[model samples]
Target: MTLFKTVDATELQARKTAAEEQFRGRKSGIDHFAGNDPVTGRPVGGYVEGGIEAVLVKYAEDLIPVYVEYTTKGYTLTSVGVVSINSSTWEIYMNRPAEQVKPLLDAILQKVEDDYIAEIEVYNNAIVDKAVAEQLAMAERREAKELEEATKARRERIESEVRQGLKAPDLTKPKSGKK
Candidate 1:
């Protein structure tokens, strides 16, 4: 069983206002209407009270583009502006002073760049050291091989001379056949 009653516009509006105030006083953050999601046509969370919605709309219209641009460029919003029904535009404030903030962010970026450059320098130095060590090792090997070849050549020449001296007549040794 269900009961239906018709209420006048003024009475209904008064009741809505009371309800919105009650809910807002008790709750925190944005209040969402059950079936009145602005973007989607479905029910979502709790309902947004009329006053909050108006303020939100005003802020979005004026500052949404600014917020989007800042965020797209990798910046964070530090503060939200005060909302007023009389004002046409919304004002947003930053958490940090512009003078202090810019230098801090720049310093951080500069430090990262410096660290990367230092790492590259270390890697380049390691490469140079490795190349020098390889060159020295190759030179030493070349010298050792040249010395071995020279020694072998000297030994062969000495053996050839001894054989020639033996084959030729020697005054100190007597001949096998008498002259």
Candidate 2:
């Protein structure tokens, strides 16, 4: 039996879309700003004023997922999630029902939104930081691997030359004296 779970997808999608759009209405709730230096806690100037799109592409990459996971339970609406975040203005949108069983859901969702910002602040000063770190680490690893390969190739070339008598003038030196 296929358990066809029922949910108000319109509401869900509305909530989802609202969550994504929430950023646009909000202003600079982010301590620094997206598309700015993560470590230095720099500001993206007027970009935050323009909303998420004003920030760099990388910073906005995972925003949708974060908003989604923060709002939904197995089949119920745990949180409304973000309607939008307007950095330039520093506003947050949590468009939710006012007549639900727990009116606190709105407040709770707001708190969660605050917590989301807090969570991001815990690790970053600006947006795109974690992304930049990951990219840098990956690039470093690749460069290191390439350097290792180059070194290994150089060593092999030297060894081959020595073996073929094109190099090496002290191959007979038994300095360790192991008989």
Best model number under TM-score: 1
Q: Report the C-alpha lDDT of model 1 over 33-140, residue by residue, as the tens digit.
A: 445567877667663322111223355465777656544545444334444445565544323334434454455445555655566667767777898999999999
- Residue 108 shift from truth in candidate 2, angstroms: 21
Q: Which residue pairs collide in model 1, if any?
A: 31-47, 31-48, 32-46, 32-47, 32-48, 33-46, 33-47, 33-48
Candidate 2 runs further than 4 Å off: 1-127, 166-179
Alpha carbon deviation, residue 118, candidate 2 (Å): 11
Q: For each candidate, give its TM-score against the true structure.
A: 0.37, 0.26
Worst 10 residues of 1 by lDDT: 48-57
Q: Roughly what TM-score does model 1 have, to 2 decimal places?
A: 0.37
User: How far does residue 10 in candidate 2 sit from its true spot (Å)?
Assistant: 17
Model 2 weakest lDDT span, ten residues long? 49-58
